[model samples]
Target: MNNAVTLKGRTEGFQIILHASASFEEVVDQLKELTVQLKKDTQKGHELIFFVDTGNRLLSADEKKQISDIIEDEHFKISSYESDVISIEDAQKRAREARPKLEVRTVRSGQILEADGDLLLIGQVHPGGTVRATGSIFVIGELKGIAHAGFEGNENAIVLANFKYNAQVRIGGNVHVIENRDENLVQSEDIQFVYVNDLHIIEVGSLHYLKTIRPEIGKHSGGLF
Candidate 1:
């Protein structure tokens, strides 16, 4: 297969490295074979997540999907993609999306709101409502509905909301249901950050220490984090 694909274990997790300067078809073929071998070695009913690292190669969205299609299996999931190259045009677009957006209206029942990057919502998210962002979510009002961050597979994204009411938070592919109803948990007192942990489970931590947890979150995001 010309070493088109190499699977390696990283300190953070496992990654499937795609060789640069190789034919796309060759890479695809190797990916398929590697995934099959991975499945054979995996325990029954077990799942594995892999980050695709395309060294010196910038892949189009369709090409990314093609790789995903090859590695997809009952036990295999493509967590995210790492590319060493990006066109100037794409970089500019990403720069624009990196800015946090603001929403002032309340999210009513059955309403769904989405943002390409970080979202700074100034209104409440009621039950039966939903909010999703490719980055993080910073709500100025009560978040009683569902909030999903890193909806596009960036696990580092987070959701900031009061934990005094019931809600659902999703970070990447991990989900956590919040049922806290204690009145003591008010804004500024019980605001929590929801995110996917190292264990790939959705978890929450106190906002008081958010700086220690994700200090860099304010970078290029307009401090919305």
Candidate 2:
């Protein structure tokens, strides 16, 4: 009998269990092989589930990068099958309520701000300034400090900024740091915020709702003419 990868779908999330006999290297090899197969047969659709044993520590950065690449590739869409899953309607409602509205300017040292909708920063957030929100964060200037989105446990929050030289970023508690600055994220006035699969924070293109939410910015109260 040929050993096959097993995937279990549950209400909460999905679980993938690799056969006990499969080694880490073998699993990786199989993933590559599957990638090829998926490419060959576009209609079949590529599906995979990765089960990580508690005893095994996932420490290989390269392997992780490869796996991430595979999952993020345009050709594949991975879904989680788990026991306790939230319905689509419930998820959307939660996302809207949990989405915060953040507005700030030059978050100084030792300042902590939290929002339940979206975050809009008019100026820079200095180092040591901490801001967290449940929805999205928009910084008009640079983000050279610590910021977190989805702090209330919602992962759909995004962080957008005019510049991306942040010291640290946490999306749903998943932290990312700027080890080095590049042109794509340096001195660029154009920045945006979005969530990855409603799971992680990402840079996107404009948060249009800000105008509607903050009507005072462009509102013209008419005087007796």
Candidate 3:
């Protein structure tokens, strides 16, 4: 009964936590109040996607629909309530393993760099070097080697590089080999990235269009990137 429904904002989005002991009716009422407050907040441009968490409770389909109906409105969308947050210890371990940064001068042939989370490289990948990650991979320098992102089956992960040559890039299970091109075809500082499109094919494009195609990665929602 205490704090039956709680709403918390995160950098990526918001989280709505429902207490396990609360009755369905109570939860629905709290959701209504939350949405009303959210409406007011939206007027100030404080809009964000939100995920629901039914702590220690498995909601029935009808109950879920009812909850969704209560929260269905502009500026508020329900992501899901099925997955629970990981334990603090597990989170810490993930944070350590997926520290999000790995800087090296140059990745030589046979050299490999991998990450469980986003990987940021400040140097170049030589012709035979390799980089693999479960999340997005960002290379600030030239990339002429192999780059594989979404290694853990995340189709949304992307591979970005400041200078592109003939590199083998893979996003999820899709792969694309950038053929050697005339250097004059692109600007000296041109940046490019590879990703999986709606048709499930790997495509190469400019970084400027990344946000347009994959907003979730830009926003870091659901640890998507």
Q: lDDT winner among the candidates?
A: 1
RMSD of 1: 9.9
Among these predicted structures, which one has the highest TM-score? 1
Writing each residue's lDDT as its tens digit, candidate 2 over 1-225 gives: 344344456554334444445666666666666656646765555444433321232325585565556544554544432223445675665565443354646788899877655666677778899878775566777787877877876665566664446467777767767533564544434564444443344434354753443333323233211
- Model 1 residue runs over 4 Å out of place are 1-92, 181-189, 221-225
Question: All models: lDDT?
Answer: 0.84, 0.57, 0.79
- TM-score of candidate 2 relative to the true fold: 0.41
* lDDT computed for candidate 1: 0.84
Give candidate 3's error at residue 173 in angstroms. 1.1
Query: What is residue 131's positional error in candidate 1, in angstroms?
Result: 0.6
Candidate 2: list runs displaced more than 4 Å. 1-102, 181-189, 197-225
